[model samples]
Structure formats: C-alpha cells, structure tokens
Target: MKKFDVDSKEVPIDILSDYILKNPEKIYGIHHNKMEELVGSVFKEHYNCEVHHVGMSGDGGKDLILIESDKSIVVQVKRRQSRSKTETASCVRDLIGATLLNGSRDCIFVSTADHFSKQSIKHKEDALAMEIIDSFELFDIDKFMGVLNLHTSEREKLWKELIEIK
Candidate 1:
C-alpha cells in the first residue's frame, strides 16, 4: 500500500462516507469541516491566492471553500481516491449549480484522484471558466525523492511511482 504524509491528520473516511451513504440528506453537515482545509492548502499552492473554506449549508459538498484576492474563487472538493470521469464530473456539475462559483473569479474541483479526462478540461476551458488538475501535478516524485536516503516514505513511494510513470 502507498503511504501519504502522515504529517497531516486524516479526515475520518469511514464515518464521513457512512454518513454520506446513510444520510445523503445531511452530508454537507458532516464533511464541510475537513474538506475546506484540504482545498485551502491546494489553493494556496496552485492558485497562489488567499482562499477560505466556508462550510455553508446546502453547499452540496463535503468541503466548500472560497479563495479570494482581486477576484473570488469558489471551490468544491471531492476527497476520494482515483475515480471514473462520471464521478468527477458529478462534483463539477454540483459546483456549477450552486451559483456560489458564479461571478466569482474561478470555479475549482479538487480531488485526491490521479487522473482526469481531456473532455473535462475542454469543458472547463470552454464552458465553466475553471481548471482541473490531478494528483500527479500536486505530488511530483523527483522533488520528493530528493530528500531520500534509505527507505524514506517520500523517497520510496515517490521514486517508485515516478519510475513507473516513465
């Protein structure tokens, strides 16, 4: 199994997923807290802007955060591992309808998944005024393995995945 930066406290998946599955009605209540932080971190690095994660009710997500500067950004996060395009697109659709993202600078969909479709990117460019980035860009291997000496978590996982991709 692959390891993640245990440096960060994990959002409880079992409780969150179960709550989502059981009370599909109350999912926003359960995951908003955890999702916002992850998006805030991603936005800081990717967008280079100050963003906030607000857990607004009826936001239709686990994490609802805003990244703002000269212009505001609305982000909807899906904290799942790699999934099919259908699943990814679903999150995109919800963010659009919320109008929370409208008139804001940009709309973003953040995921733990390692992949996305070209069609998704095209739609993002053409229709949504958004962008889609995957885990690969977020977690590159060489920089991570640079700190490795002997079986380090970053070195081991990062190097192996980098080699496999090449």
Candidate 2:
C-alpha cells in the first residue's frame, strides 16, 4: 500500500483513488479524518477558495467549509471502507439541515464510495425541488473537482511566500 502525506497542499488524484476508491483492501487502513483533510486541501487548491476543516465532533454534519467570494459552501465528506456501504438519504438530510442552519443555500456531499444510495440522490433532488437549497452537488470518487488551474497554483505559491514573509 502507498503512503500519503495528508498535510501536503497537493494531492494527486491517482493516489487518492488508490487508497480510497480503487483498492478495497487498502481502504480499511485509510484514516477518515486525514481523508477529509486531503479533500479539503484539494478543494482549496483547485478552486482557490478558503477551505476550512471542520470534521470534528459536533461539526453539524459539515466536514469542510469552502468560502469563495461571497459564498460559503458546506461540504460533507464520507470515507466508506466498503463499496457496498453507500452514503444514505439520512446523510443528505443532515447535510441539508446543516446547510440551512449555517445560513448557506449551497452544499456538496462527497463520498469515497463509488455511488450513493438511490434514496440519497432523490433526497438531494427533493431539496432542489422544494428550493430549500440553491445547489446540492453529490460527488463520488470519480466526480471530484478537476485538477488545479495554473492561476490557482501561482496564487498558492504567492500566498505561501507572503506567509513566509510574515
């Protein structure tokens, strides 16, 4: 099994998949909280957003908070060891509740599992139907956001330099 530096700002998608998605045997050894950190870092690097880790106890179902411009998006991360253990509707409901409670209309549910239960997908659709949430994106391993853009990398480097100077 391959090891990962969870604290790194850059995480290759293949490495993430090897441990979290493609290899079932390796998944059990993966640390759930560290996976959340990796996901948060990926989002921070890819979107150039301020990603905050909040996956501890009483996090209100949100693992990460992504702030971009004036919008704050709640993110829920699920690292399922078994492929059969899909994210359920209740998870979606809790995320919906959390999103509203956080005063944000947008949320994203991320899971290492290959897919979510049908009920979960319907729940997300229902939330949109009722206009309770402006956006509810469900991302499985294959559906994660794409690679970081060049501009984002440059921005990250500049930010690191500024931090070093301070």
Candidate 3:
C-alpha cells in the first residue's frame, strides 16, 4: 500500500483512488459516493480544513465546495479528458466564470487530465472587490492520492490481479 501524511493526519488509499475514481466495487468491497468525498478527503489531509461535497449532479457546473475555516472554496472537478488544448482552457475558464457568477472568488479546478493553462495563472490577482483564483490544481490519480497522505504501491498490482473480473 502507499503511505503519506496530510496535515499531520494519515489518509488511506480508500479515500483517494477508490472514491475519486468512482470505482470501489473493484476495490475494498464497498461503494463510492460524493465528489466532495474525494475533495474533502484531500483538503482535510492537506490543510486539516473542514469540507463538504455539493456534488455535480444537477448542481450546474460545480462539483464540490470546500471550506477552510472561515473562507469558502468553490471547487470544480474536470476528471475527464479534453479533445484539445482549446477545449481544456475553455473548461477552466467556464468553471472560473461560473464560480464568479456565484460570487465565489476562490475557485479550484481539479482534473484527471492536464488542464493547466497560463491564462488561468495570470489571473491570480484581483482588485479589492473580487477574489482572484489562479487555480487550485491537481492532476493524475497518484498525485491526488499524495494530496490525501495516501499512495498506490506494488500492492495495486496484486489488487488488479485479484479484482479483475473474468
């Protein structure tokens, strides 16, 4: 198994890959639910902050909402691949725009694919009236798990052998 530390707390792999990947039946004999579950698990480990998952189903373009103490962070998970760089940048811009419309200045975008852009980073600062979110970025399943004080090890190979259906 993979191991690490998040905000002095140790988050297991269960809260990372199994939940974020939305595939638990093939994992630890359970089901995975809530986009916030993945987000919460990460922020909790990284910052030791209180968090919740609003989810994306019927909630428009947002996936999760994370709260760190008094400040609230509006989060969007782009866990799918984009056909091209333009599409990727558009998705990030759209997420930021929607969060701004909702009056949240702190916007975070998480994706399974590489969606990092220079334009997003350039807009990290704003006037006193607005909150500028350059980006709260995360990429790759392994890195996500790392954020949660978790890891995927050689044990994953064994898991695949045992869990793969015939």
Q: Which residue segments of model 3 deviate by more than 4 Å?
A: 1-36, 81-87, 115-143, 150-166
Residue 136 in candidate 3, Cα distance off native in Å:
4.6
Can you rank all candidates by lDDT, best first? Answer: 2, 3, 1
Q: Specify the poorest-scoring 10-residue window by lDDT in model 3.
A: 24-33
- Per-residue CA lDDT of candidate 1, range 68-130, in tens? 456655666554422332334445545555434354434656554445456554545544333
What overall lDDT goes with each candidate model? 0.44, 0.76, 0.52
Residues forming the 10-long window of minimal summed lDDT in candidate 2: 144-153
Model 3 accuracy (lDDT, Cα) = 0.52
Model with the higher lDDT, candidate 1 or 2: 2
* Winner on TM-score (1 vs 3): 3
Name the lDDT value of residue 70 in candidate 3: 70
lDDT of 3 by residue, 1-166 (tens): 7654322124553544544345422222222233345555566656567666666456666766667777666777654333123225566667777677666766676654434565554443331125355344534334554554343333456688888864
lDDT of 2: 0.76
Using lDDT as the measure, the top candidate is 2
Q: What tens-digit string does per-residue lDDT give for candidate 2 at 36-137?
A: 876786778666799988898888899999999999999999877665568888999999999999999999998867788899999999999999999999
